[model samples]
Target: MSRLYGDPIEVWTRDGEPTQFVWHDRLYLVRRVLDHWVVAREWWKTSEGDPGERRFWRVEASPGREVGSYELRFDTAGSGWLLMRAWD
Candidate 1:
């Protein structure tokens, strides 16, 4: 899929679990926390270090009734945030 520039997103954790996320540029609040998870993978093809990994946070929101997750990639090269996955 193609993404526009300057998209807004959020990342959070549930019950002290790893971080998760919801994607949106508009301001909003979490009416209630549902669930959260994390995803980490090695990017050997794009990595240039001993351990090049990407981290993601999957979260379920209530009010919006949206499901998906946020991403946080950490590698010897760099780190950044992204919208990993989403569903209705």
Candidate 2:
């Protein structure tokens, strides 16, 4: 199972791929990208706002300990990035 935080994070990317992200005051380096996909906005779910497409990444990351997988989402409408879930 994964926990959802929806917290905004700062990410560093290389060649259009995420390499690292800052969360909970720690830097987690992405060791591997497990998967990636795009989620289109659900128009019915938004009555007042729409953010377009959201890109997600399932990655294995490490912060000087045992590596763990995480899910991240990037909002294309300028809402920035979010650390959606994490497997610890």
Candidate 3:
């Protein structure tokens, strides 16, 4: 099963890559980055040179012994991190 989330998370990065994140008061360490990508949409319609793109990292992470798949999003415009999804 997969769950979607829009909750803000505190993330720590190394080499501009997500290394750890805290969500719901739980700390999860990134074990591996499964994928990394960017999404930009309707760029021609937006103003201020904003491409409306979001940086995403799909990773395998764990707060404890059990590792889970997580998708983290970085909002370039706001410089905020969000927990986008989780897989169980």
Candidate 4:
């Protein structure tokens, strides 16, 4: 897995599942969802911050002909999405 860190991305979802994502000016279609989970905010990290909950998805996708695995995160507080990592 490689870190994309917190790179923001545009995603297309259906029935709450990520169907595709646009990253770095390219679009990748999700072929499979390897895993999905939620992480609670670490309230202890900042006394005045409410980072909110995060939902994560590990998926397999194809940008072209080759399929690869990637991880994406959704911030519930702001409804923002991030590409967390890619296993290439």
Going through the candidates in the order shown, the clash numbers are 0, 0, 0, 0
Question: How well is each residue in 15-43 modelled by candidate 3, as lDDT tens digits?
Answer: 98999999899999999999999987566
Compute the lDDT of residue 51 as modeled in candidate 1.
Answer: 50
State each model's CA lDDT, in order: 0.41, 0.89, 0.93, 0.90
The alpha-carbon RMSD values of the candidates against the true structure, listed in the order shown, are: 5.8, 2.1, 1.6, 2.0
TM-score of 3: 0.89
User: After aligning candidate 3 to the native by TM-score, how far in Å is the CA of 73 from where it should be?
Assistant: 0.2
Top-down lDDT ranking: 3, 4, 2, 1
Question: Could you tell me the lDDT of residue 37 within candidate 2?
Answer: 97
TM-score for candidate 4, residues paired by index? 0.86
Worst 10 residues of 2 by lDDT: 42-51
Q: Score candidate 1 by lDDT.
A: 0.41
Residue pairs in collision within model 2 = none
For residues 1-88, could you state the per-residue lDDT of candidate 4 as single tens digits?
A: 4766678999999999999999899999999999999998887764558768899999999889999999999988778999999887
lDDT of 2 by residue, 1-88 (tens): 7888999999998987799999999999999999999989886677657748899999999988789999989988666999999997
lDDT of 3: 0.93
Off by over 4 Å in 4: 44-51
